[model samples]
Target: MNIWEYIYSPIIIFIASYILLRFAGKKAVSEMNSFDLLFIVVLGTIVSEPLVDKGIPSALSYGLVFTLVYILFSILTLNNKLRWLLITTPTVLVRNGDIDEKGLRKARITTDELLGTLREKGYATVKDIEMATMENMGKVSVIPKSYARPVQPSDLNLFPGAAFIPIPLVMNGQILMHNMKYLKLDEEWLKRELTRQNIAFDKLDDITLASYNAKGQLDIDTDNDEGHNHNPYMYKPGNTN
Candidate 1:
């Protein structure tokens, strides 16, 4: 009833809820397995004790502790070894265009489920997939067979090379020495190039990007450092004044 209890109650409940969820395990929400679902429901009911019992702030305290525990556990899992404990490795449902019946059974995925997932991914038949994987997230990934796959640019007789040669320049408030070395360029050359284009060096910082195309055409993107509204995103690197 007191203001202190009112403010602290929710905090406690949240912590307790979080900790209980963490204890239940990461699979508890993401995997959507039957057992994990049951555990979460039961845990939530048990952690609701203090909320119903007005005399004791048990629910709030429990919730607060639970939340902290969940967060800490997540952080721990993000580091090296502990991560595997929280998440399962991806399961191969199909390999080399062949279905892995044993792996499918282990993953608890039915044939219908597998086919449905493939269909959703534009593979109406099993033969269409060269490889099928049931990732840890429980989503089925399908790689189309070479014959069934769409033709890429290379397949259409296009040369597999850079669409445009990238011209590198320094624009992030510091001279990019590595880029200059890579391009066999120098500061003096850069200054002269900018001078030829009638651009100021101090205003170079206004340039978000600058590049050169394959033909060695300099592309300089710049904006008004004077705070005038301009389309900064649309400005290409070498198109500056």
Candidate 2:
């Protein structure tokens, strides 16, 4: 009911929620499994208790309890016997270009819905699908028949070496010295290259992103720094100009 309670409740709860969520395991909502969803819903309810009649201490305590339970449940799901009760099994809906009517019924999806899902996955007809399965997370995964799939280099007897992930030399206008070191590059090399692109040293932060690819190419993207805004409450970085 008090203003102070309203102000402090969200701040305290946010910190608690973040810590608990990190411990609980963070991932995109779309990628969350059933147990993960349950954990999130329970956490939301527990953290929101402080906004009601309950105190922050009680809410955080309850959140910790649930997080422990989530961890235990995660461990239990790893066992084959316990896994059946914990996790939903993936169901095959199509195999060998044939639709499994029983699988469709078990998955609770209509034929029309299956057709739409196939279309979204780039398959125009069921005949093109070698296998389509309903994953535990409710995503429909489709594997096209080999003959129906796109041609690849292997099909033409061509082999290309595997590539490594792209590393960033700079990000958000700040030099990633650690990454530069990892890539065996130094500050002087990066500074010289940015100068060639007309990116002044002081204006590096205006660049939204800068990445160095495996092929020895530097990609840069910049935003209008003239429209940059700063928070009055925060300490501002010193400007060169």
Candidate 3:
């Protein structure tokens, strides 16, 4: 009735309602069966009464507690039945480049919605998708067919298949003076690399990422190009084959 009472009542009711809702289990909105929907509607109505009425009664409070217990028990049973309820589990919207029409109908998802999800994943055609699943979280996950996936350098016949890992040589105009010492190379060699790139030693601050090859070449990348390897000699001259 008072401001303090109003605030405390809402707070208490919210805490209790949250606990009940948590005990109501993890059925997603899309995954809720008909009975779960009824329980949700009833739970909402019961929780809303305290907000609407001027005073809450002991009987109403007891009734809400009973309803919460019943709902919790029902949720436990439903969660147990989840193994048998194939519909509640995420349905395969597409499989092996074919749309499962029965699954689409059961999931109540429109063709347009499916298309939109595919487009969001950069897929222009259904043939590109090997499998698509409508997750319980209401998100669509798609796996592109092997043929539809991006062609790697190896697939393009450009891979030498050598195991190589590039390590940082310099960063932000500060010579990794320790790295030079590790590779038994001096600052003078690094300066020569900077000279070859026509960039000043002090101006290496413009570099965002830099690495050294097995051949001890200082590779430099600038912020202007998203730190891509700007080294002219990444591939030697006339070796495009």
Task: Name the candidate that leads on lDDT.
Answer: 2
- TM-score computed on alpha carbons, candidate 1: 0.47
Error of 3 at 85 (Å): 3.5
TM-score of each: 0.47, 0.81, 0.46
lDDT of 1 by residue, 1-241 (tens): 7789877776776775675666656765786633345456655765666556763355545555655555576567677787677757778888877789998898998889888888888888887778888776667777888999988987988878767768567566556778788888887887877787777776687777777567665677676445433756545566471
lDDT of 1: 0.70
Candidate 3, pairs of clashing residues = none
Model 3 score (lDDT): 0.73
lDDT (Cα atoms) of all candidates against the true structure: 0.70, 0.85, 0.73
Worst window of 10 by summed lDDT in candidate 1: 31-40
Worst 10 residues of 2 by lDDT: 226-235
The regions of model 2 sitting more than 4 angstroms off are: 27-30, 195-208, 221-241
Over 134-193, each residue of candidate 3 has an lDDT whose tens digit, in order, gives: 865467889999999888787977967576677787776567777778888787887788
Residue lDDT tens for model 2, 126-165: 9999999999888999999999899999999999789667
What candidate 3 gets wrong by more than 4 Å, as runs, is 2-4, 19-42, 54-82, 150-241
